[model samples]
Target: MPEPIIEIKDLTKDYEGKRAVDHLNLNINKGEIFGLLGPNGAGKTTVILMLLGLSEPTGGSIKISGYDSTTEPLKVKKITGYLPDQVGFYENRTGLENLLYTARLNGISGKRAYESAEKLLDIVGLREAKYKKTGIYSKGMKQRLGLADVLIKEPEIIILDEPTIGIDPKGINEFLDLIRKLSKDKGITVLLSSHLLHQVQKICDRVGLFVDGRLLAEGNIDEMAEKLFNNKEIAIKAQVSNITQDLIDDLKKIEGIRKVSYSGDWLIIKSIENVTPAIAKSIIAKGGSLYQLSYEKYGLDEIYQYYFEGGVRHD
Candidate 1:
């Protein structure tokens, strides 16, 4: 496997007399989106702060691209871009002006700065609003612009915190699409910290479920499901035409098939493994028309709820 672009080992943090992060460990590969998922006050922001060198960790270490966040903070910041939940810009400055200013700060000057800023504006679908003052930009518009701001620095990694809190559904989709496009096109690693499970599930390649400053689980949805559920059973739903008792009996006879039943217009099959193909073959052989077939894939929301609500021990 390729070396992880970002690494955190036994990372812990404390505020006042309470611990905010506890023995957290994670690794993020290059060109992949890693979601840090949890609710409010889950220590997500604190971890981000430590990673960015904005706050010191009470214990443990963080390394970004091989630069120690604590000792080589400047080097870490040089290759990392951060977007806070609430992005701020010069309200009186036009969108283009804001981007140009950021580019200048990053040492890209003269015509190069303008070209880079304009390119990012177009890439983010904000070219028309480039000349509009940011004071009039909506929340979604600001979030997009914030993305453009982060890109101005040409950082290898971008950290976003609560990026879609108040945007409408359509806006959220568009913003997320832009993020995915950037990661795929530029090979940038993204650390998206958010409380929204569904939105994170839509873009993240892998997720770390965080609760009360601890990482309860980590992996893609399917991998996590196996770890948490122990692969005990799988549920499959199928819609077939001309269903009969004989067809149901045949399905149950298939190896690994445990139980078969009818729910509404769908046949629900509980099995020890995914037997979708076998189920389909049986349906076709029995002269039944298959309309829809889907297997139970655990979603992030279900996994989060199951683990957090005492379905499993954190240990």
Candidate 2:
């Protein structure tokens, strides 16, 4: 385990009479990509904004690298870069110009800003079009440019909100690759908030599941699965040729095996523990040819669905 660079405790935000964030607590480790997940109206953006000190918390505290987000916001801003759901850039300004402007705002100037901006433009794959006005850039290009703009501050932490929301599949893939590369190469911590479960599953090291402003669970894929499926049965699917009723009965008789049934060429096995290898051996011994055998594991989407619908208790 790594040291936690961001520690949040009892963080809360109230919107008029409604509670947007209800006592959320989380620890984000240094150099790790942590995904903040939930449906719309779940306060995911509120948490992110509070983390960056862009919005004040109604209650509780947030410490980033020991700098209090509420009190020493300037210090927090120096090390944190935030990209909103919709990135804004001067449409008339060239991509290079936008980055340079950000650099100047951060107190970097002259050769340093220019050189740094060039490298970042190249890093984000916008070098050739660096001088072209951003108005001519596509949505993906603007997103990439926004990334370069954020990097102008040399932030230790990068926070992105729904970065791939409207991106085409190909563009989303490219952007995600760049995000992973940046984190790995720069040793920068990243906190991502998105409703896209598959995309988050592809990259997040761990995730905090949020619902109605409260964290329902915080864990990696396997850990959350264990918590949610503590007593659930495992399903195994096997495709075999020339199956027999006798073989099904034999499989059902195996201790710990809950159920056995076959449909067409697919044999479904329900068991408490993994006994696929034994099942395969038995099928082979029964003079059956095995073509495919696989056990089913819950994907993030499935696990998320189970968590919310199962009425998970927030801890």
Candidate 3:
């Protein structure tokens, strides 16, 4: 495996008498979108603050690109770009002016800065709006500009905290697609922190479940389901033209099938693996018509429901 671009070991944080983060350990691979998934006040923001060297950890360590966040904070910040929940810009300045100002702050002024700023504006789909004052831009437009601001520094890693909080559904989709495109094209590692499960699941290559400042699990959706459910049986739903006791019994007898039953016009089969192919063949051989077949996808929705709402202990 490749070395992780971000590494945290035994990280902990405290505010007053309460512990905000508890012995958190995580590693993020280079160029992959890693989501910090959790509910509000779950210490996700604390972790990001510590990673960016904006806040000190109460204990343990954080390393980004071989630089210690606590000791070499300047070095860490030099290559890391952060976009907080709210993005602020010079409201009176045009979008292009705002980007140019950022470029100048980073010491890339003159024709090069102007050219880069214009290109970034086009890449972010704001070329036409480039000359418009940010005060008149909508929330989605501001977010797009915020992303352009972050990229102006040309950082290797970008940390976004609740980046899509108030945007409409369509805008959210477009923003996510842009993030994915940047990660793939520029090979920039992205660390996204969000409480929206479905949105995170849509674009994240992997995710870490954080609750109450503790990371319960981290992996892809399927891998996390297996870890949390202990390889729990899957349910397959099928709709056929005919249903009979004989057919149900035959389905139960199929290898890997644990149980079979019917409801209305649908058949519900609980199995250890996908047996849809076998099920369709049996339906046709039994002089029945197979109308529909669907296997339950083990996704973030189910995982979140099972762990948080189902009262299943992570331990």
Q: What TM-score against the true fold does each predicted structure earn?
A: 0.80, 0.82, 0.81
Report the backbone clash tally of model 3: 0
Which sections of candidate 3 miss by over 4 Å? 231-297, 310-312
RMSD of 1: 5.5
Please report, in order, the local distance difference test score of every candidate based on alpha carbons. Answer: 0.90, 0.89, 0.90
Best by TM-score: 2
Q: How far is candidate 3 from the true structure (C-alpha RMSD, Å)?
A: 4.8
* Local accuracy of candidate 3 as per-residue lDDT tens digits, 1-315: 877999999999999989999999999999999999988898999999999898999999999999999999988888888888988889999999999998887778999889988988998899999999999999888899989988988889999999999999999999999999998999999999998998899999999999888999999988998887666768788999889988987887789998787998899887888888998888888888889999996678878865667545576
Report the CA-based lDDT of candidate 1 relative to the real structure. 0.90
Report how far off residue 40 is in candidate 2 (Å). Answer: 1.7
Q: lDDT by residue for model 1 over 1-315, one digit each (tens)?
A: 867999999999989989999999999999999999987898999999999899999999999999999998888887899999889889999999998888887778899889889999998889899999999999989999999999988999999999998899999999999899999999999999998899999999999999888998999988888887776677799998878999999998999998898966689888888889999999999999999999886666558766667546568
CA RMSD of each candidate after superposition: 5.5, 4.4, 4.8
| lDDT-superior candidate, 1 or 2 | 1
Score residue 131 of candidate 1 by CA lDDT.
94
Give me the runs in candidate 2 sitting further than 4 Å from their true place: 235-294, 308-315
Candidate 3 vs. true structure, TM-score: 0.81
- Which pairs clash in model 3? none
In terms of TM-score, which candidate is stronger, 2 or 3? Answer: 2
